[model samples]
Target: MNFRQKNVLLILLACFPFGLIAQAQKKKSKVVTDPVFSAFSYKGNDAIYTDNPLKADEFYNPILQGCYPDPSITKKGNDYYLVNSSFSMFPGVPIFHSNDLVNWKQIGHVLDRRSQLKVDSAGISAGIYAPDIKYNPGNETFYMITTQIASGIGNMVVKTKDPLKGWSDPKKLNFDGIDPSIFFDDNGKAYITHNDAPDRGKTLYNGHRVIKIWEYDLQNDQVIPGTDKIIVDGGVDITQKPIWIEGPHLYKKNGKYYLMCAEGGTGGWHSEVIFVSDSPTGPFKPAPSNPILTQRHFPKDRKDKVDWAGHADLVEGPDGKYYGVFLGIRPNNQDRVNAGRETFMLPVDWSGEFPVFENGLIPMRPKLKVPKGTERKWEQGGYFQNGNFTFNEDFSKDTLDFRWIGVRGPREEFIAKTKDGLIIKPSERNIKSNKVTSTLFHRQQHNAFEAAFTLKYAPRSATDMAGLVCYQSERFNYVFGITRKGTEDFLVLAKTNKGETTVVASVKIDTGKPVRLQVVANHDEYRFNYSTDGTNFQNLGGTVSGDVLSTNVAGGFTGSLIGLYATTGNDIQPQ
Candidate 1:
């Protein structure tokens, strides 16, 4: 069964235990608690520095690092705006603004409100798919279109006048496919392109997808019927039966319509192809040199090869140069996909009819020259800065940082920041639960790093618990928390793999004082430690393998996240 179908079955099974009469009368209690926020302390050695300090000409690859995938960029005058898919994380669709395209700062999220994002039933990688951002000069508004698979809100668009402030509510559209994109012609006509399932009797093989387009009627705010057409079926060569031709984007240049898309799925064979057409909906011709961008041909034994390079979007730099931003994976030890897919930037040369990446399809370089006259400036908020540094968050501010995110839509009352530290009210939804919970987490940017937190919470019962967690998903994760059993409090170390929970170790601790929990991750192994005085820590459990928490092993599209969480157990009956 599909994810939505399985979710329905799970919901039915969840309600099957209670009888009809009990279920009819049962009402869940409104658990209200102070908002729980966290302060992060980061220390790392892998800092990026430019080669030419005077000119600031060179910059590092993966410009917006760490699980930022399926990038869509649009240039508005001198400022460039970009957005990426969030996929089950709250505050979806992070919007970034940049002047030189080398340095980007996250301005805000397009879907920050609970009403805009409702992915409680969405799996780790099944919530928000590829998002496309565009700005309409005619209307003077920014538009973002994406598909929320779990919520069944197919092809929705959200707009805003000022991206720094907030975005408007989602305007659901009637589109039949995923990865929806908008293209505005110079004649003031708008078109929507997406990847749709193969038509009946047209599929010679499984996974045969087509790129379709339809004219969007902004007047009525709907896709106009009878304007639907298939621009590229399968791929450039339909006889070869290319698989998964998706992420279609239309660009108009020099009186020609350019349709760019990714082909051959999102795996190692992923690649970018281009097509040109005289009309927005027509018999487009593929570029002579197809698969213009990819790393699939790189030698597997190459030390610094990047895999899964596709789903690219183009933007013009400050110096009138074109640049491409695409998704690529930097595998860890044993070829494990731990960091998830990251955003990589490459210079685009456009002297030819069709634009091509400067480096062709080879592995992206570690360092490249930035656009001329590009200056580096450190701005506040969640903007990434290269070079060895530390990020210390005390949660003294009223708002959470852009780097911090929760699963699905966390309840507002479940999180708060106070003088004593961040307070999180225990919820019935534990880490193992697929639903939303009071768990605030940030991505694990480095393989070798330490995440330590001081959680000060007194458990009233055995059910109330709070601690630090290295979470991959509901199925695979490790939790180190302080909980009470009877009148005694203990520091607990637990692991949940494939839906089975096992308590590895538990140590009786004094509940009179606060607890400090730490998890040190070195490549593949993680060690858990705890302390009462916050000066010294004692190891509580044996080393845990980080492989089980990887995307390849855990079967998710997200990277590992280290964060603070609180749970009241699942046995709490409805009020």
Candidate 2:
């Protein structure tokens, strides 16, 4: 090696240990009881789950993480089981298991059956809506009810033998509902409650503005027809409100049933309300302290116009503490919203027969608390999706985590696992799945991070190519690849979003040799580079802004993903 090259390697290695030290020290950046707001703009930033330890723990109220909306949880012994809305994301209804209500891990999904809904090629926000997860020990089956919103339809139920696998086929309830929740009576009879969307039938006031609850007969396995009754009618409060009341979950405390739901539009900062009922079917009334949880309570986010925080589910913690989980948004910019709508948690307090909500914002820094005999693996993917799982050794699971999702519905031909690593076969498909063969990928979480993968290419023709990409949309993103021209190898960086390209270098190398590739993606920007000798590095001068993956502009049910791809070229077809 040249003297200059050797010196550069020494400097890079010498600086590596310092980076690790900084990370260790920065872990506690937010340790205050009430964190003072930092004067930083929210624009172009990634999701923030941890309170800046340096700032204090002021914003740590909501314990659960990610985009877990409309949480429904049940207590079994000391263990807490939770599930939430998966929308169009496949393997829907993520099931989470926790002991303390603070620390939770995903177990599996509930809607594993095809009868519940067809998801093979479903569009964004098309599949399952909010779902309520409940357990019936008498029948020893877990029940789930979700609305398939794409078809403008409502309510389907499924049961499972074990928490991890083998769920029964969907049993359609055939109601024009949006959110369906289940409540098990002490007498062992189960009841169903939902927001009724009345058929307008040529009237201005058509959709059901009322929340209904009724006796559900499992023997008949359907809503007890005609036994349905209105528990809470919005009356004047929800008039002209299109977002309306949805995501109803029932929790009986003392002698009252607390029907907690999300109201107002799902966007902006003006959402949320909690009500109570003396009987399962009531003259349900709003808690005197209504709108129990709202972003209005978070002084900092309120000043900037952050919108929407509702759709709550309640569960008694192992310590006999009451807690609630809901959906909330943290906007990236004041003018535009991106991938927001995250799962949040808070303590639930009861005053007399009513529930009280204080500390409107989430806890500044949240920590997970588990049971004595519990294992971490079981709680990892139980309710929704779990992201930020690290794999230093070989990947340890047969199935993927709820954290892993694709840009579009992935086909069997686009992805496979070879002996060396995961093989992503490319197709003519655009990143948006417009064509159907783009092999983009992402880990399911709201954290800013990066990942690296190794690859080997065997191109048959000059046009054949293989490489890695940071994918937000086929119309918007960047890619770095190794393409063969005749017998020559070239390093190219292409910005798909802007339609720009800049080739870094070229070398005459054997096509049969393996190439190690790496992608360093900032939650704010992306940098890609490749290594030929496995020691020297070559920088590809291209980086795409992370905002390209934002949910607002991209128009999808998920955030951006990182993946590898192989596409057709000159005339080569390896397979």
Candidate 2 residue 153 C-alpha distance from true site, Å: 7.0
Tell me each candidate's TM-score. 0.89, 0.74
Instruction: Write down the worst ten-residue block by lDDT for model 1.
Output: 45-54
**Backbone N/Cα/C clashes per model:** 5, 50
Per-residue lDDT tens digits of candidate 1, residues 223-306?
998888989888989888788999999998899999999998888899999999899997899999998898898787676557
Give per-model CA RMSD.
11.4, 15.3
Cα lDDT of model 2 by residue, 209-286, tens digit: 667777888876788778877676652255544446767778777667777777664654445576766777776777
> What lDDT score is found at residue 204 in candidate 1?
73
* Alpha-carbon runs more than 4 Å astray in model 1: 1-39, 45-55, 379-382, 570-575
Top candidate on lDDT is: 1
